[model samples]
Target chain A: MATLKDVAAKSGVTVTTVSRVLNNRGYISEETRDKVYLAMKELNYQPNEIARSLSKQKSNNIGIIVPHIEHPYFARLIGYLEREAVKKNYKIILCNSHAKFEKEIDYLEMFQSHRVAGIILCSRSVDIGKFVSLNIPVVSIERPVDVGTTSVECDNYQGGILAAKHLIARGCRHLVHFSGIENEAMPADARSKGFIKVCEDNNILHKEVESKADDYLNMEYHSLIESVLKENPEVDGIFASSDLIAAQVIQVARKMNIQVPDQLKIVGFDDVSIASLVSPTITTIHQPIKEMAQEAINCLIKCTEDSVVPSRIQLPVSLIKRETT
Target chain B: MATLKDVAAKSGVTVTTVSRVLNNRGYISEETRDKVYLAMKELNYQPNEIARSLSKQKSNNIGIIVPHIEHPYFARLIGYLEREAVKKNYKIILCNSHAKFEKEIDYLEMFQSHRVAGIILCSRSVDIGKFVSLNIPVVSIERPVDVGTTSVECDNYQGGILAAKHLIARGCRHLVHFSGIENEAMPADARSKGFIKVCEDNNILHKEVESKADDYLNMEYHSLIESVLKENPEVDGIFASSDLIAAQVIQVARKMNIQVPDQLKIVGFDDVSIASLVSPTITTIHQPIKEMAQEAINCLIKCTEDSVVPSRIQLPVSLIKRETT
Candidate 1:
């Protein structure tokens, strides 16, 4: 936590002199360099590699890889992380992978060539091997890495169970779960599994309806819901993978004149701001967005040091019940 | 635009040499530099300053200043800008002013000290004088700067008049407008003014109830609406400053069992993603977000090149009718 000023004061030199010494740039005496080095060591100061690199390498910027910033969940998550990053005095280069493998790789390579401080991988594309090859600090959001790079994630399985249990408690019998893109990371996949596991344990008959949206706002979700409705008209309970998907379900249900909760209980994931704004509101599982963001920053900061940060750390998820269920 | 590779091929030199020549970095022969410069001019190759700045400044970072990133309006705007920034291979550093003058000043100082290439000011809270003194290219989003800084804003006054006209068309006799914070240099203020002007022209009995929220959340909105309702029970139509605020009106109205469109017609601003997601949807003014973002970026780039960009530019705002009004 020792700042550049602290080290400068301790070393009996100007902040700029200490910065130069730390960066190994500009003309400075060996004695002054030695003094600053000793001062830094004694204070346990880790020069902001990003800042230092930014000053010396001239582009100490890192890229934040996300699927979409417009999505409510991602927007809130980005907001928290942006605040934390600003506090630390690091610039974030935002990358919207748009879930394209080529774009993801392009961003990683761009970050590598541009000399960013680190990579915050919020994208679902799990191509960690390529990132590792770049020899940069990679802190993934939600998606956990197995090879010792820092990661911050939410307990998706727990969130799934919470959603299912809320519906089950509301006396839902013929239930169905609306999932996001299948064959993805543990986050969405785990949520689906948890729902099934909870349904089986509670001895409830359940069916799965996977939506084709990348995350949420897609024309396919409405058609998907319509198709699902045709086959599962008796389905009295529903759990959507996202708030956007849940919003679509609500619209579809309204068109069909099905009253929420009274006729059909519904629960959504990622209790975004829209959850309460929508009519009938929406019961949703709330991921610890601010906490997770802070944790991601903390993990990356830890990675900056020699500390061994966890590769996969799961934060708690809570079910926020509104009017829907 | 011709790429670096195209320039290099025309100049009969390697990409690295062309890059170095464009960046004004490293030692290159005079003849080679001349060739590259001539070739660039011939091909009309615009160098990516971001890529070049990375090598020289150690952080090819662009900072974005928004009032609040959590708000869907700003969030979606940031998302679009982020996407565009990514396309140009630049990283985004987000700073939230929370609509505070002091915070805006702090971020300006921070971004300057942090050596950001440029800043995109989205609804800045700081005075125009401070911005003029920075000697940096700044693109203001939705706020006009008195100084010679480029700005991209929506036609707020027109939007307001349109909303009022819509209410009148809906057979509203007594109308109330929910305005934004006092003395905020936002289009919302102009919107309220336009509403009043339109009402006066039509000889309509209209009342303005300005309810300032601490931020863009539903915190003060509900209470504000309650008080407005108590004071203006005869109010048959409502014009809210934001979609989020409009959604709160729905919540409050439902609590009182007031029928929307039948008893009271409501209209909100900023057709954000949740505008349609919310129940009864929302009949609001649509700000061309994507085009605005691109314009802001283009303006900033022009300013960087010492070009004369407009001090005030207003994009069109359309009234989209959904279910609300």
Candidate 2:
């Protein structure tokens, strides 16, 4: 709790002398350094990092803004990012936007005020205009906002193609894809598009059943699956946008006495933890989450240092064949 | 990027005058305030919050230390805490301990050096000894430490009791509880203790089979469930410490053709999003994550105040029956 001034006063020297000793900047006599050390030890003075950061105009900290921490995918992504951030000797300031525009703007302003070295926008709530105006190196998770910011994302289109191809390999002719959010720049939309493309290329019968769920919440997944099942009674193979959605599909399948991987071969995306934990363990697209997280953090740090890196970095996705497929 | 001195020099005014106008502290004339504002606008002067915080010897930021953010329970809890902290005009600096004692200590020291308002430690890594020397309010979740600090947690004992009573009410004659951890200051242990007590009171044939998993990882759950099934053949009913674990139990049961709620009644703790999303929707104990998170934030804020408030807040828990039990 002791300040530099207190240590200086105790050491009978000016504050500049104490600062020089702390920063090891200027020449100081051995006696003066000893005196300063004694004063610091006596006063229990801890160097104020805030003051140091202010002086350098750069804090060894990064800010991460996410839509919601509660979502498992984002939570896992943040966990990996936090680990990577710490490994790079930088701390993280976490802000939850809750998928709100005003909250995202408030976090950006706050991060600026906090003098964050850079920011990683995991939430796609803010507009491109609001994002580009910050003049900070922002690495977006999914939303490719502007030209200048770096982005780290999984190949959703490839993931979708893999899902449909696996279903076709399993000899499924009739297919229905359950997708949420159509008009957004989300990876799920890309997945749906890829599914359709693959289905069209292979000459397979495919029907798209779109739902208006904001991510994969339980209530939303339940309602969405219920409606999709009601409309498409003869659909055999199902490709869900998220594993959470796929779990819902399985739940609905059980209720309707429809056997999975036989009566219906279901494939999910984002091989989240629950994918393997549940019954008829989900066959999902494994987004290289840890690698992508590390890449995003490294890109942000690089941009903060040099600001010369490309704006977009897309990682590959692969199929994790489990019980469902 | 411009400093106050730059603005002051541009406006031909003293730095003190500019500072006063910026803080709105002194009785400055409207013309003088406008002149300072114009100069600030022209130079794009942004006030340094870090500098101001150093000068004030405090910051409007709180530190949150959690073991892993990927865990659904912790993620939801952190989400709630973040919203509450934002509402209270405080920012959250996140530190992932990764369930390591050294990492927790390192993060604690770093947060202290940064002069964070207070630290809310949701880690189960270290005991009270690691935090006894710190001159900061340390509110822990699930595990209370350093007697004087505030703690906000769910009633784990009651949660355990609720799970046991529900299973008994559903006419479960044989019961077995699975735990990932043996014994620590773990809420799961408390739940286990309560369950054992309830079974004893009712004179039911009760048994406990702890898993080899260290934490709530998916692979851990898989191996744990495999061992549990192999070890306890007469375990007609199961109570897993987490929904993920319970989901694994369901998967294992299905593989062994043990019908849920009919042949093998199972209950999971921490009714996370996956609980309802999974098939044979897990009958589990619901942790009051939102309320507990808000309380943790409020407690940290109160601890940050000059006069710290020391209190132990136990949020309520309940049983949400779906289909498994």
Candidate 3:
């Protein structure tokens, strides 16, 4: 139960100097900082971060809301975001909204009460209007929130274009693009739009099959993929919106006795680890997850500093060729 | 800019009543609580959680330190932990230490300063001595820390036995168990011990191949698995330490033209999503991740309440039969 005054007395410094060292604010000599730390260690003094945050009116915490952490894409994104946040000495308060709007709102209220420096929204279940009145800086990843909220997303449209062009270049005649849930108005929906435009411009026979919300929630698409392949035997190429779906396609193709890269070519997006771990490693669109995460943190910090950052930041994506192509 | 006094005045209540409503402590009528909330909403008053925590000397946060968030096992564990935490109105301060001791220590100090109610240690890199002087409740997951620390873990030893017995029951002779890093006193190492014991009792020829730390961090076990399979062609049954390694084994076997379950029956540990997602779905030992997570949180909470709880909690595991076996 040692107080700040006790540490200052033990370190032979003023209380203000001890507080400055603890806050890491005003510049102090390296020797003085070392003395304070040594005294704290010897006295077993634990500074109250809550009191410090209350005095500063800001906490070194960034609220992160994601739909699901078990999903490979979100898992990778969260990992990269944590790494980037740690570099900036910011901790993340994780909230798994599970794509539930009520849960998202509950977490938002908690973040506000806790006075987090910023919020990084990875779940798109909540409406953009919910954040309109939020005093905290909000940064949405992959999903654009609103005109005032900053968003960091890879070029989903260009990723779709690259996947379609790659499949066509590999001599695919009939192609199918497996999209996410229909009518969601997500930023990722642009991938489907880009795919359709490319197919129409190339004058190639193509079809778009949308996955349901259940498929996403359960991370199970084998049955849907099996049916799609059975009904469309003529389809020789597929562009899946996620690597998880692409992996499922590969599994279904293996069961159907359809030879990949011989009778069919496939491309996946978000080049997560599964894209390469699966056999006949998937050719996928790399979304620059690390860079996107860094940018999201940067945008949130900048917004916290009262700096004007661009509302929309679209990083580039690249097509990674593997055995699937 | 709104204060508690303002909210109390607008609600036609005393400041004490408003404080009680905000803290949900003293008994208050539902109508009066609603009035306080309405007044706060009208005034856009955000109650400062930091100040409240300072007064209470506690925080509704559980600090969680994990090796890697992107790893499937840890990802699923974190998801379940978050769900369990949310149920109890507690938030998680996520720290991905990446199994770095220094980083873990840094996060531990931060957790202490922040006065986290408890800490859930998922990373096993730090020594048990580190938690000896920690004033907060420390619950270790899977790995036992010390006599004072509560640990929640699935029956890893029994899981190893189950996998071996299942493989042997499927008419396999030569067996190989792929273990984690050597010389690490992890709870998972019990799997290797159990596998060896069962093999020895059954008079089955068995070999153990240890995966290096690099194989784990990179999640790349293709070359190691390929080499082992190539060198030990006589090995007809394999028990992998994790589903990730099992998936890689499948990929390597495919490359070597080895038909699974016919030429080589494989069983993996940790029934994560990837187990079923991969073709020739892995037959793994199912760890009750949800139950374990709940138990860990329950233990931490019980400790916080100064209740006597068991030091070690070992949950049951089961064998999941799939195409691999």
Best of the two (1, 3) by TM-score: 3
* Tens-digit lDDT track of model 1 for B1-325: 4688999899999999987886688999999999999998897565544455534443456778887788989888998888777666566777777677787877776666555667888855457565565566777888777576777889999999999999999999899998877655567889998999989989999988765547454334777787788788898999988888888888788877888878989999999877788778889889899999888877766766678888877899999998888
Candidate numbers, best lDDT first, in rank order: 3, 2, 1
The sequence of per-residue lDDT tens digits that candidate 2 reaches over residues A1-325 is 6789899999999999999999898799999999999999898677878878888877888999987687767888888989999999999999988667788887887888788888989877466554456556788887667777888889998988999999999999999998766555567788888999999999999988766536433336666676777787777899988787788788888888888877888998888887886788999999999998898899988887775787789989999999997
Q: In model 3, which runs have C-alpha deviations exceeding 4 angstroms?
A: A24-34, A125-134, B25-31, B128-134
Better of 2 and 3 by DockQ: 3
Q: What is the lDDT of residue A271 in candidate 2?
A: 87
Clashes of each: 12, 0, 0
Which docking category, incorrect, acceptable, medium or high, applies to candidate 2?
medium
The lDDT of each candidate is: 0.79, 0.82, 0.90
Q: Is candidate 1 or candidate 3 better by lDDT?
A: 3
Off by over 4 Å in 1: A1-62, A213-220, B1-60, B128-134, B213-220
Interface RMSD of each: 5.8, 1.5, 1.1
Tell me, by lDDT, which candidate is best.
3
Please give the RMSD of candidate 3 to the true structure. 1.8
Q: Encode model 2's per-residue lDDT on B174-281: one tens digit a residue.
A: 898986565545678889888999899999888887654364433366666777677777777888888877887888888878788788898999888878877888
- Measured with C-alpha atoms, the lDDT of residue A18 in candidate 1 is 89
Per-residue error at A74 for model 1, in Å?
0.4
